[model samples]
Target: MKAFGSIALAAAVTLGLGGVVLAKPLSRIISETGLSPEDFEVLSATSDSMLASGTPRAGKEREWINESTGSKGTIRVLEVRDNCASLQHFIRPAGVSQTRQIRTRRCRDANGNWILTP
Candidate 1:
């Protein structure tokens, strides 16, 4: 029956739209942490400057803050050997009471640029 087919199509359309509404954004899925893109930019810049300005050593640290979003964090060098360094990131997103810590590594390339590495 034409009416039955129409209803089925309408239901499918409604369910599809509902699924889209419930879908999480790609950025949110990528970063389970509450850090926004702006937050990551600020943190990256701080880490680069600290690691590139001079020879990095364990315990060297820097702090970054995004006043607009009220997100703040710290990047600390945990270890350094040769041209590579391991760092720890402490992030506190806005409106959050608990801080999240992440570990990462960077190595200076032949061009003397600090590059994030897995």
Candidate 2:
């Protein structure tokens, strides 16, 4: 009886562990940063706005906050190429403890819209 009980317990544990191993991967909640595709879009848009006229370059940095989510971060234009720009972005999601720093480059497409490259 003890041997049967032990076998049943072992099988239960093995099945539970197997299920865990096959579970779906964790979400990319932060979504952007670390050179992800999402990061490219977010940083490119912000850089384009910064390059627009009337957006002061006094401190070479801009702060943005999402009033709805309370998530905030900073964007800085590191360099501007003839047709492209490099940027540094720091993003912190609401309720997240760690902020992410990402660097990427954006260039003007034929239609004058900014796009990410490489």
Candidate 3:
């Protein structure tokens, strides 16, 4: 009985942590960042090696360049909290050897819409 109780407690703790990890609010990140849903359309939903490594391995770089500025960066959806969603865009100029992370804050517009601030 004691062993069963321990197992149940462990399962409950694991489930609780999993729920928190999965329950991120992404909408608030978008609204506060001022990134329209349309902008996300151009972003890669998943992290790709080309973007992370800064080398075009297989994907067409031209398409990304044509869609947006020729900026190389990572676009990720970050959930700041339960009520906020944010898209984190990290950009580095082409041909640059070093990488840097840029932060953009989200704010509401006059109509209470979220906007991303540089």
Give the C-alpha miss distance for residue 100 in model 3, angstroms. Answer: 1.7
- Computed on alpha carbons, the lDDT of every model, listed in order, comes to 0.68, 0.51, 0.36
What is the C-alpha lDDT profile of model 1 across 1-118, one tens digit per residue? 3333223322322233243334454364325667666666667678767976777989998999998789999888999988888878788989899987767677888988776654
lDDT of 3 by residue, 22-53 (tens): 33344543343333333333333222222333
TM-score for all models, in order of appearance: 0.74, 0.54, 0.32
Each prediction's number of clashing residue pairs: 0, 0, 14
> Number of the top candidate by TM-score?
1
Cα deviation of 110, candidate 3, in Å: 6.4
lDDT of 2 by residue, 1-118 (tens): 3333223322322233243323231222123222333333343345556766532333378777665566667887777767776666677766777886655455677877555543
RMSD to the native, candidate 1? Answer: 15.8
Better of 1 and 3 by TM-score: 1
Model 3 stretches astray by more than 4 angstroms: 1-69, 109-112
Q: How many backbone clashes does candidate 2 have?
A: 0
Show the lowest summed lDDT stretch of 10 residues, model 1: 5-14
Candidate 1's displacement at residue 25, Å, is 8.4
